[model samples]
Target: MTDVRSDDRPTESLRDRIATELGRARDRSVRLTEAVDDDDLVRQHSPIMSPLVWDLAHIGNQEELWLLRDVGGRTPVRQDIDELYDAFKHPRKDRPALPLLGPTEARRYVGTVRDKVFDLLDGVRFEGRRLVTDGFAFGMIAQHEQQHDETMLATHQLRAGPPVLSAPPPPPSVRPVGAEVLVPAGRFTMGTSTDPWALDNERPGHPVDLPAYVIDAAPVTNAAYLAFVDDGGYADPRWWSGPGWQHRSSAGLTAPMHWRRDGTGWGCTRFGRYAPLVPDEPVVHVGYHEAEAYAAWAGKRLPTEAEWEKAARWDPVSGRSRRYPWGDEDPTPEHANLGQRHLAPAPVGAYPAGASPLGVHQLIGDVWEWTASPFLGYPGFAAFPYREYSEVFFGSDYRVLRGGSFGTDPVACRGTFRNWDLPIRRQIFSGFRCARDARPDETA
Candidate 1:
């Protein structure tokens, strides 16, 4: 198979690759938007998330700012609406009241920007400016669109209606029953140094020394979480921290979000329909606090951010890190679940082909696995383009989530990619797997 990662490609091939990626990203966004009506596009599903129309236009505005203005040296096309699309200036709750563009106007504005961008690409030289040198600006904008595409899919799940989005289920997984895998103590590179399109948070790869630890071969399953719930894990304050206990009490969260007791058994809603909770599938829509409580109840803890990366990418024999768990190869349907290919997670112990060298499974895709670490930058971290993308949220306030979910696009997901959210949020596609420290006398 040809390696698209090679840097020796012809200039024309490079441009074509960029255009293909941008088109795929845009198509995915459009498909997600078309699933809902104009009323759904304008309605705010949650105060925390913008209406679908806002996301549609914001994707275009960012593309225009980075690709057309910054890289192509083109003048602004819609200067008056910049502030309306400025994410930092306007919160999601206030977006619905703004003098926003209607769905038709939003489509026309984005269409115009894209046409101008392609025209600029036709005659552009790839070697002079920093932003355009290696097609960095184009790659960044493509990634930005794909990220918002995932967010828009989340809005569709949050909106109340019959299921408008559909895809065939992932192929059944046939891996053996999983067990904890032990990672030996050693120094390993924790982030990226060579990925050209990597965001600032994953730069200046640093070496981290970690003691031996054991992590689950697959993410904690819904069946396992049910065991915790049956044992009064939520009602007992012993398994929760002070703040976590307070939040759970106030919210009255008995099970994961969108889950309820049906007669005698449990059922959960997905996209608008309720079905029996699949026992073998990895749990989703869990908050950091709930994950922590479950870990405590299981007599284990969430792995630190460094530990999770080490398990996913480090190869003990090669003594180096890889681009992904299955090596540098890009994701495929046979390897993992992603790109909104399915509405839910595959059964735990699925995707053996995507397992880490140490035999950890589903580390790349399933759901965003919550780590014990806070959202902080590595050594020598520097913000690129802007600080709002990552630097502003670096603190103990937001917890880190590693590994992408089913809604994530491959263009935006990688082994080193870092995602963070408030510890109390349960609206996202998030889940957890427990880890425990290895005994000093034990060996891998």
Candidate 2:
């Protein structure tokens, strides 16, 4: 993990910044709640999950615990704040009974504590001693709030809460997009050789071959896959693989993880915000089971990692390997909808300039595509110098996934970087495009 040094202004005096962040967190809480109703706020899919209102309280409680009491050495706020919001004890259930202040009072609590902590920090003159407690407290608070941000998205995707939309995502642009065309059968190196950010399983840069095949021009989108769902895709067992069938049955997945059908067209629900679903944006949060079922229903299959890379990026227009689909010149805004701007996947085909040689619309960003490959070490693959890296799950439960998502740091993202997860998992940032053995005419 990168160790971030405390900023030069670590002295407790910067009450202003803390106050700003506290208010910002409260503002975010209000925005997240704007679309959700009391009934919806109380709903949850899993037993352990907390309510949005509870989440807001915990966010403040965490801030107070770390920055106020721990670092600033101030008398603790109402002692109940710890008992109410303590994640280690409370786990997931939302208890409105935790003595949480009303929205107005919660905002005040956060703001006041922030001001006091900052005021304390400004006066402390350390003999250059690392303020480990203070530094960790700040970082921990940041992480705590970030977890809520994710929970906000997860709650929306699950549709456990009523429909909500705080911000309307920008409309999809008027850009014509193309799909991943065919690549000829051939052998090529797939997976990362260097520690170009190798996940635990992508080590050993395995060489794999692809028979002639066609891949989807891009990821399966809300519009395209909706046809399968409309045709009773979920109810049909024949369309799912053995394991996929079991998963679908248990999870009771009926639609793309992030989509909520409003009226006729679909809109994505995340962070309690709903926007018109991009007809061409990759359907996200659907795990391997959903991806497989979609492929079977559509009479296509996911590409093997080699096949996916071969068609989408490997056969680059230039012979040299570039980190991204377009070329090696890192990424700019137009190149892909990375960064945290929308804080969610862009509509597919938004990044035409970033298309791969095969005309794949979003070869790099928007959603991390699931491939047919299993997570495994490569031939002659050894774990990197970092011991916990690749050796843990050689032939374990994880499956291979590729292409980073919209929220990913584009600098760390690349065509070859690999990620993995258990098969049953689904969330808003994960999804797969389809690929299949090609008819002779379709092969490159």
Candidate 3:
């Protein structure tokens, strides 16, 4: 909301919107951390993730740094502990021993910071500075918190216990979708230049010319992935890249994470509860290599970042890009399975309403779809506010993922939004759809 049209609003509306977003984000953070006992909050569920208590405090620290200190010109509330919460200063594996604030203290500190932010919001101007312009900093902080909330949700998925979370199931697929959609590619704009809250990596929209291609109408589902597993996809080196094969061999990845043998079919654990795999639901908890291997077995390949964007945002008739697959508007519940409305991905064709104009389905949410591209700044890219936000990670070390996942909050996800992780990571809610060069006749 802050990035879309925040500056166009009256001062009151802008402040109200920012306040609402901040509140919503905090609520999610609280729910995630509070659901578990203090022991669970302080324990590191996985080495790749921080203790839940650390995330709780870090969210407040970021808000204080950007909104209270930088925008409001206020002194730090706890200058001594800044390093304790600085993410770059400490990796997730080392966070638990860094004198992190305990559960009670973490909650109280964030509450204090939030109170000060509200006071500052009452008087902060909407212009005269880039960070404060259009309430970008506030919006950014809200997004940051939501991002951590998603991470904490992932941590919950990794935690060992009875179910600590629950939500109603996502709507079932309304109808069958075709196997693939042809993207009649030409020059289509990529990234964003006008979104008020768009992060640095997503700025400076540019046109990308390309040959036509074919892409999956929906993400690969459990049923489809099952075919790969049944065929010994993991054991076959023919389908995997060199590095991918090495990792698969060492890690002994037989199936998607949390998946185990059910008597007659496959079963998967979600938030500690196990159930039979829903054949039509998009597969989750997959790494890049697994997805790549599956694509190869299917006689296809992962889409390039540009190809994925063209399929999602390009409108053939209008010759323009939209903010989402459905249109320029923010997502509704019916649009996609986002914001943890469902604790897992919906069935492949469940969100036909969210389909792209080219007829691609479930493009915005359900799972983070891996792309062929590595993390890189767009052409003419420039860092803003800080390079650590995106620039520092611009290299082949991390692979790019488009769209958002069921754990993703809408504020932190958008058409141009970029997410990257080490290709070997299997703990996140990730999946993919395959693509291929269009047949000569199909291009027309």
Candidate 4:
């Protein structure tokens, strides 16, 4: 990880950028919550996820913990409720039974925290501790809020009701002529070492050597996944692993979550509205098991974590990695579907400008792509600030997912950022692209 030893302090422009990002994150959270009623906000849509109200207060609680208390050295605003909002202390299924702050109280608490945080940011020095240096604490808090915003979006997708959110459709897809592209054998850097706000898991950039392999030019779309469903892919035990088959059988899942057979066709529910599945859109909410099964059925495999990173960030010409597929510039509307600008994944091959150096489309956004690798730390990995953020989950049980999703904020999304969850999880915005070893007959 980069140490905060530089004498140079934050500039006015830097402060403004941080402030703008924080405001956008907070505003997005409010907009998502406001779209649902108080009853829906308190209702737990799934056992795995917390009630919307718990997340609202949890956002404030975390901002207060990091920005106000840790960075600004302030006393707690509501000391009695800290345990109630502690994620590690309480599980999601039990949170609804807790006495969480109501809508009015939660809004007031978050607003007050924001006020204090902004006040602290105005005059705070940005060169002392790691948390304060380069406004890392503020950036972290903003990212935390934005992450919760994405989680709340998941809640919206799970909630049952008429449409509570809407957005103009994304650009039409141009069906990629080549199904996949060959990434030449090479050594490439896999993570970041200098990004000031990058989390502990993405630190200490390392080298990885990979053989030539072919990866999908775009994510598997609804049209493609539907073919798997139509061919009894789920029922075939040959395509699924032992544990995967058990999970599929127990759940009685024949198709992706939120999808139901409508006579001779299929319809999917998104944010409480059911519509005919969009054939070209990247498939969302598929679990790791399902992604793996689909790959096996297609005579391919999921890309490893290293391979995925190499495909997205490696620049063969320079022998270096860029901060994003499109380069170091922050994301723009034309680059990818992000920041809740759209409630669903854009069509496959839609974001040509966001393509990587090798012409792989949508490498940075649309949905989190499941990889074949398990979630593990690098050779020199060490937890910073706290271990709970990532260290505890580094094991074979959780699968690593790369790229951000439609609800991901640009401030929180990066080429090296890592997300992980259990393989059985299908509620979040997750999908996958297929990969395979280059054949002897194939030429790059």
Best-fitting candidate, scored by lDDT:
3
User: Backbone clashes per model, in order?
Assistant: 0, 12, 1, 0
* Of candidates 4 and 3, the better by TM-score: 3
Candidate 1 clashing pairs?
A: none
What TM-score against the true fold does each predicted structure earn?
0.97, 0.64, 0.97, 0.96
User: Candidate 3: where is the Cα deviation over 4 Å?
Assistant: 1-9
Please write out the lDDT profile of model 1 over residues 1-444, one tens digit for every residue. 266555645667878978898899989988988888899998999998999999999999998898888888899999899999999999889999999999999989998999998898876778877677768788889989998998888888788878899887765768775679999999999888888788889887999999999998889999999999989999999999898999999999899998999998898998898999998888999999999999999999999999999999999889899989889889998778888899889997678889988999998778999999999989999988789999999999999999999998888888899999999998889998889999877672
- Give the better candidate number (3 or 4) by lDDT: 3
Better structure of 2 and 3 per TM-score: 3
Q: Give the winner by TM-score: 2 or 4.
A: 4
What's the true lDDT of residue 381 in model 4? 91
Candidate 2 lDDT, 1-444, residue by residue in tens: 135356744433333444444444445556665556665555555554566667766777777766667566788876666776666565565464455566556656766766676676555444342333234334335534644654664555566444454333533755766655777666666666553333434555566765777888778887888888889998999999898888888888888776677898777767555788766667777888888888888888887877777665565445433456786667887887653445566776577788876687777777888887787777777653333434675575777778877655453366777767777877637888888777866643
lDDT of each: 0.89, 0.66, 0.93, 0.89
lDDT digits (tens) for residues 213-310 of candidate 3:
99999999999999999999999999999999999999999999999998878999999999999999999999999999999999999999999999
Against the true structure, candidate 2 reaches a TM-score of 0.64
Top-TM-score candidate index: 3
